[model samples]
Target: MSPDRSQTAYAASAADLAVRALDALRGIGGTAMVAEHVERAEDPKAALAAIRVVGADTFAPYLLADAVFHPQDAAAVTQSFALFPPPVSTPDPPPAGAAEPWLVAWRDWAMAALLARLAEAEPDGVRAPRPTGAPVLTDPDHSQVSDAPAGQGSDSHAAHGDGLPTPDSGAPDDSGPRDTDWQRWSVRMGQLSPLALPGLDGPVHSAARAAPLALARGATRAVLRRDFPTAARITRWLALLGAEGVALPLDPVPLLAHLRLHGGGPRLALDVAIARRLLGLETV
Candidate 1:
């Protein structure tokens, strides 16, 4: 099969898998097992390709809920990386206003590493630093979100109430140009949405903490443009902020419902389902 075909098969499988995971997340039906959806094939190459596509999110269910992390699942996620290999190491790009792709890949790996650690399977050979599962912005009991106050500032910096950069704003020195263009900024947040889960934090989460309204605005814009995938990704950030008690520019509840209704495919559905979990909207 062509790469596209593999992706098509994987996306359908992933989405269905996400639906099962979502059910598990809501305490309904059976637990979502990674091996079932991720390994529904005899073709090792295809399975590996699918794992690479979803990256760390392949273990999202385990992270989101108390789902068991069987050894096979851990080995499958680990083996896929060995088969496909990680990206070539790249130097830290100069502190810039926008996120570079390398940074996003590293963040993705951080999520995977966190899950690997939870599974107690120190995946050998992978190079991303270990992720501390410390709570960044999650309160397991958190379940409410509010709208931005009337006349609140909407610029990128002020989008975060109080207009202060969080502690882990960026590189150690915290020096370098910061991107203020909401368009680019929102897109980068969307790409790094995989980091929007509970129990993880860093530059990306810090960056997100600095821009709730911008993230909400970007998500609304994507919805208007019929770019559901982009909208859904940004929604993940919005959902996270809402959970963190940040006053958002929009309500995440209806937005999640909209995506569930119109966001094409299981992959995008997976994003929305994850967003729903972030928002604590535990229902069908």
Candidate 2:
């Protein structure tokens, strides 16, 4: 097949996958039920199934964090990780708000929670050395650094210190791609303006901090890396945050569709579509 034909075929396959993933998500009832299954299920397989249904949507990190921290089965936990595509060597950047203070905070919290779980699951897992010159996680709205020394602001330090997982300290495995990719993305995102919503009364940053533009860059990076799970997760958050009054720099539905057509797999594409529907951004 010609390169163009192959590309077209791949897009068609991805679109079909996105549709199926959306259907599966809709059939799962709602986020409340998905969270319940992850938190209360006695069987890891059942939880994993529910998670698969949830895919990389907004609630994924929450559900995954719960499973990671409170493992029903170690093998199941490992399997759940596999449900996500392998970490692409060149992941597309995260969707808009990837570096927004609120989103970053949430992402860091979820990552930290997962790392903590990994630490508990494998007491003797091989530890990787912490990378030097790593980007420090910061609150975009505030100038305060999260990793500040203990005495500077005890309260702030207590609240946000090390919320992000350090790759060298407590990684689930020796593979550094996840951390490396995430760090690189974070640094890129940090260069953007604060992700404040339109018409919302808050600390105004420069107009350059457009949400849609930021998200577009993020989605592209995520797609490049074939990190569909992260792509889906970021898309959902973008929609949710936009609904909560954040201004989007661009229409997300078309952007998501573009990603679906270009590189994202079915599950990832479907996840974005589902988020768009839920946010009333578009109808499936």
Candidate whose lDDT is highest: 1
Candidate 2: residue 175 Cα off by (Å): 22
lDDT of 1 by residue, 1-284 (tens): 88888778766554555565555555555432556655566555665566666655656667666577677766676776677665565423313212233444555466466655766666776555532221122111332222111111222332333212323342232223342234444654576666777767666666577668667877887788677877888888888888898888789889889888884876677788788777776563
- Report backbone clashes per prediction: 2, 17
All candidates' lDDT scores?
0.59, 0.37
Candidate 2 clash figure, as a count = 17
The residue-by-residue lDDT of candidate 2 on 77-174, one tens digit each, is 34544553223322222222122243333222232234334435432231212111222333333232323111011122112333333433333323
- Give candidate 1 regions above 4 Å deviation: 1-32, 91-104, 130-180
Off by over 4 Å in 2: 1-21, 24-216, 223-230, 262-266
Q: What is the TM-score of each candidate against the true structure?
A: 0.71, 0.35
